[model samples]
Target: MIDPAYVSAMARYNAWQNENLYGAAASLSDEARRQDRGAFFGSIHGTFCHLLWADRMWLSRFTGTPKPSVPGSESSRMIEAWEELAAERQVTDVLIGDWAAGLSPEWLAEDLTWVSGISRRELTKPKAQLVMHFFNHQTHHRGQAHAMLTAAGVKPGDTDLMLVDLRG
Candidate 1:
């Protein structure tokens, strides 16, 4: 059985991280959010949007939902309007935590396959690894987003997991 507490903790972590990210993003001028920062996505807003795209893509494969048509590259992601994408990303992260809580060992053990959005060919992998990838991928891209936000002159509050106030 998937422990509900682990899921709840992850959910809170995801929320806390994004709250800091967006809070920092908000301090920047639109021009700053859009500035090139040498990240894979090259800007705070672009990295944020790409993280959302990756989360949705992995969730689709995990839950059999339809994968979105958004291209997961840095350029296509930056073309989106920032505020709307940030809000949508929040919703998707909550859904992922909920899905993770209900997952069974069997579900995680099963292999998932989907046509690669990049290559248009079938790819399959164990679901446990993919689910882990989903969360890890979020952290990876969010770190890039965080760094870019700093370059844009916005301070994202503490990212330390130990600092999360679980009782709050």
Candidate 2:
């Protein structure tokens, strides 16, 4: 069984990391942020957009929130405007935190069945595993975005989870 505390902590960490990354990314010009740097998502901006789209997609499944209209193949350009993207990111992070705060063992222990947008197939899995995937997906893409930020000459500060100060 997945611990609610761990999910909550991860939600906080996800927000913390996004804030740091977005802050650093703010220093770069729009062209620099969007320039293709050979990352899987092509650029820092593209990767960030993909991350936001994926979050929204998963959150929709998890919370019955509206699923993002963009298809998986087009996630890289879901939000082309930097300002809008950043604002949505903040809102989504808050939503994730709030959702995590309400998580319980009962909810986590159940199974979740949903249609896969990418594969176009029905799938069922433990809700706990799906919750784990939610956070894992964020971390996986953020790492790529972090590298792209570094390549663009932006330092995203420390990324160690243990060092994330959650006391505030």
In lDDT terms, which candidate is top?
2
Residue-by-residue lDDT tens digits, candidate 1, 12-125: 787889988888888777888878888877778777777777777777877866666756654336337777877787788678767766777677668888788678789997
| Clash pairs, model 2 backbone | none
Judge candidate 1 at residue 154 and give its lDDT. Answer: 72
Query: How many clashes does the backbone of model 1 have?
Result: 0
Cα-based TM-score, every candidate: 0.85, 0.97
Model 2 scores a C-alpha lDDT of 0.92
Candidate 2, residues 1-168, lDDT tens digits: the string is 678888899999999999999999999999999999998999999999999999998899889999988889999999989999999999999999999999898989999999997779999999999999999999999999889899888888999999987643
Evaluated at residue 149, the lDDT of candidate 1 is: 75
- By TM-score, the best candidate is 2
Q: Which ranges in model 2 have alpha carbons more than 4 Å from their true place?
A: none
Clashes of each: 0, 0
